[model samples]
Target: MKAAVWYGKHDVRIENKEEPVVQPGKIKIKVAWTGICGSDLHAYHGAPGVIQEGTPHPITGEMAPLTLGHEFSGIVHEIGEGVSEFAVGDRVTVEPMIKCGKCEPCKKGYSNLCDYFGFVGLQSNGGFADYVVVDDYMVHKLPDKVTLEEGALMEPAAVAFHAVKSSQMKVGSKVAVFGVGPIGLLTILCAKAAGASQIIAVDVSKERLQKAREIGATTVINGMEENAVQRILAETGGVDVAFEAAGAEVTVNNAIASIAKKGQVVIESIIPHPIKVDILQITAKEANLTATLGYCGVYKEVIAMVASGQLDVKSIITNKIVLDDLIENGFNLLTSDKSQAKIIVSPQ
Candidate 1:
């Protein structure tokens, strides 16, 4: 089996390795397609401690030289002992979240908030390889209406659905999404599905903003061209809910400032560093500031939406590359081109 292994920061190499075998309570999947995530880009950019190297991950206990592809879909090649929900040749998408079921949060049905939660691709051998073995609990069967490409997007779409569902967004609520990347674009779709009346998408890239509008954003703003906050305020008074998905200091501030009084701001992106915020402004408005981590229990809903043609996950895909070209054609293309939305990696 060929796998892209991350040995260190900015050091991902494809090497042939023995295929993973099915284990008890787990299933072996022949990976069909995988998407390179922003977190993978973070690992490639010399982010310290993201890819466990010297110290092992507390939950998986897996360190560096780990395979890297979490947003993926595949065919169930082999079923492990005790697994009965799925059999051989079932097409499925994985949730890819590893959690301690005994944790207080997990006990409360909020496994995403578990104390020992770790993402599969980051902490274990992920779907980047030709074959992956994950707990049967993580598998979600894809309907006939959903293709393997759309199935590959289930993980990220789940994140978007969770973000919108977790927010205090009501019907006809005005929404703004700062950042029109895959996650941000998907967030727009989720907001629309949630019955948001107006969605304002803010991004620096014109191409992404256009794509956002095509999906469901009622309006688009190029932060690089105009004052996004002022423009948004002038157009809609102010959004009822704002989402910061750009994971940058400027966009975070813009998201906070673009909402009306008593509005809520959902921080969706992983802003790596701390920056000064206008606490007085947020306090004066009596607005709410909330943060969202990974998703929990939303895979079925997203898959249903996609299968019903309510959510077009396929439209977000811009490129497809083979596993051998993942580094150059997938990751490098994403890093260099801001216009690219989603790039799928075919592992077969």
Candidate 2:
């Protein structure tokens, strides 16, 4: 099997590795497609500090120098003992978050916050290769209506859905979404489906904001062109919910400043740097500040949303590359001013 293995900071190599086999309580997926994620970009560039040599994975206890690529979907090549919901030849997408079910958060049905949560690509050998071994609990069958490409998007889409749910966005509320990256665009669609009446998709990229509008964003704000704060207030009278999807301090502050008084600000972005914010302004507005970790408890719901033809994943997937080209194509996205929406990695 050929895989793009994580070596260290800025060090990913394409090499042949032994194929993963199905184990008890696990399933083997013949990975059809995987997507390069923002976290992968961070790891690729030497952030996160999770892939360093000899560091133990919090959940799987697997160390670094592992294969990394998560967001994927594929056909079930084989099933393990006790796995009954799916079988060979079944197409499915995986929930990357593998939880320690005995943990307190897991007991509370908030497993996304589990103390020992493990994301596939980061914690173990993920879907970067042609075959990936995942616990049965993490895999779910894709409906016949959905394509393999859309199935690959389920993980990221779940992240967007989780961000929207964390804010507890209300029906007909006005939303201002900052950062129209792939996740940001998906967040807009999720907010719309959750009943946000007016959505302001903000980005420095015109190409991205244009994609956002096509995915159901009612208004688009190019931060490079217009003052986002002035435009939000001007357009919506006031925004009820503000979602920060771009992982930058400036966009986060933009989200904070654009909302209505007492508005809810959902922090979905993982800002690379420590950002100093005006606590006084947030205090003065009496707004609710909420932070979303990755996703949990919503893969099936999001799959349903996509399957129903309600949420469009097609417009967001911008590029597709094969396993041999993963390093070049994937790294290009990290370094370049990507006009692309999302890039998919095909293993087989």
Each candidate's root-mean-square deviation in Å? Answer: 1.0, 1.5
Q: List ranges where model 1 is wrong by over 4 Å.
A: none
Model 1 Cα RMSD, 1 decimal: 1.0
Question: Model 2: which residue pairs collide?
Answer: none
Candidate 1's error at 26, in angstroms?
Answer: 0.3
Model 2 poorest ten-residue lDDT run? 49-58
lDDT of 1 by residue, 1-348 (tens): 999998877789999989987989999999999988999988888787566677678777887789998999999999999999999999999999989899899999999998977888888999999999999999999999999999999999998899999999999999999999999999998999889999999999989999999999999999888999999999999899999998988887888899999998999998778888887769988999889998998899999999998888888999999999988998889999998999999976
| Cα lDDT computed for each candidate against the true fold | 0.91, 0.85
Total backbone collisions for each predicted model? 0, 0
List candidate 2 segments past 4 Å from native.
Answer: none
TM-score of each: 0.98, 0.96
